[model samples]
Target: MNIKKNEKPQEEQLRKIYTPLWQNIFRGATENQDVDILNILKKVPIFSQLTKKELIKVSYIIYERKYATGEFLFKEGNPGSAVFIIKNGTVSIEKSNKLNIKDVYATLISGDFTGEISLIEDSERNANARCTTNTTVIIIFRHDLFDLIAREPLLGNKILKDLAAMVTKRLKEANEELVKYKLLAEVKNDH
Candidate 1:
């Protein structure tokens, strides 16, 4: 690396620009920190099968942050970029109705993840996520995962497979719930 008379070190520049994001997320992933993160990821269903080594690779790209109650992790229509895993506290997923009132569709807790679609697609978030209490979340941006995949195809492929399976399962469950709701509406109208 060449140093210019007027320029600051690259590391310094990065630290200044991304300080908050890195402060908690990238503190070197020390032995104790690695075990702590590995334990959290292990509890998450999508990453359940990843080996210790694989999880360590994944951990390098993770960013963890804490939010106060009522803060939004993301808003509906925001460009989706990362998947978030709730490490503690609660987050509620909501959407606006025709009347513009936000209706919460789901409340997520520890070990649950959201925004998985962002990992594979460039799309807007369909719902909003707001913390219902002080919360800690682990975020993995799509670009980071893709870059890792480019360098480690086997690991990337495994993550992609797991993400796909998780999404498919959720879609199926949502479809079932929709059917049940439709049936209930029909029954109510018949009376």
Candidate 2:
């Protein structure tokens, strides 16, 4: 992750290209601002309990990334280093396959979190994320999240519990969907 001195300038320039817009969003998250980003985040159930100050703090560690339509954010089975919070536009969650056309797993919108499985275990990603449209996302690096949690155990614990609940809920929903599909298939075959 350490870049040479010569690479630092380029890295900083790249960071600057996207940081301003995200900074504006974070600043708005701190105070009562009428920005669109604030309203979007306000609708997110997971962050509903977060205070403005805490939201701002969470924002500080976030980096903005923009992706063009059809660009793969990360491939399934690649090592994940950061999780993404969709700030704008849509992302497709796809499954890996040997066939030319991969399976479309799910679609993610603004406020949706991805790459969370990396936090629980340092393993290859389970799915691929591709930009379905021109997309802008807020990135939270795993290291930064870990460090923040380490610095504030109480806040960190709360975040972890929230994440756990989210994962659990999603799993249950998927299971229900699977059962419904199976039952429907059985009914059709019974005819």
Candidate 3:
């Protein structure tokens, strides 16, 4: 007896994964009116230079979410799926110890984006984000973004460059803060 190859199972599995994601994205978008909020992102330093058309494309892939104060947006080591733009309130980025989150490393306020580092590199989240107040955020998923890049290389390159520059600037500021803290510690020790 001859055995035949089965492609149906693989196709069904893919459809199962993609279908719900597409539906969720569409539902989130329709409910949240993300386009209106995304308009404000153009004023953000990293994305301010993006043209109107570019912004529109980016807007479509973004969805708005609201979190109650003290709610965790993500935890360190969790898989990064999307980058977030803070629309309202603040999010505290904290480092996780073995069993608890501690050391408030950064507070991202309105007009700031977090998790972009993971989008480009497909890495685990480096820190935890918790809502410091009732917060609103706009999220753009990495897979949706990658698809856009495949179709539009120029716009994608511009976004990637801007993201890299933003990360570099943040890193520099963080290094300076570390140096300042180290100096303060040494001064205190001498007393």
Give per-residue CA lDDT, model 2, range 101-156, as digits (tens): 66565667666657767777788988789999998877778899889889877667
Which consecutive 10 residues in model 3 have the weakest lDDT in total? 22-31
Number of the top-ranking candidate, with lDDT as the measure: 1
Candidate-wise lDDT, in order = 0.73, 0.67, 0.70
Any residue pairs clashing in model 2, and if so which?
A: none
Residue 133 Cα positional deviation in candidate 2, in Å, after optimal superposition: 2.0
* TM-score winner between candidates 1 and 3: 1
Clashing pairs in 1: none
For model 1, what is the error of residue 114's alpha carbon versus the real structure, in angstroms, after optimal superposition?
1.0
**Shift of residue 182 alpha carbon in model 3, Å:** 8.7
Sorting all predicted structures by TM-score, with the top scorer first, yields 1, 2, 3
The model with the greater lDDT, 1 or 3, is 1
Candidate 1 has a TM-score of: 0.73
lDDT of 3: 0.70
Candidate 1 whole-model C-alpha lDDT, 0 to 1 = 0.73
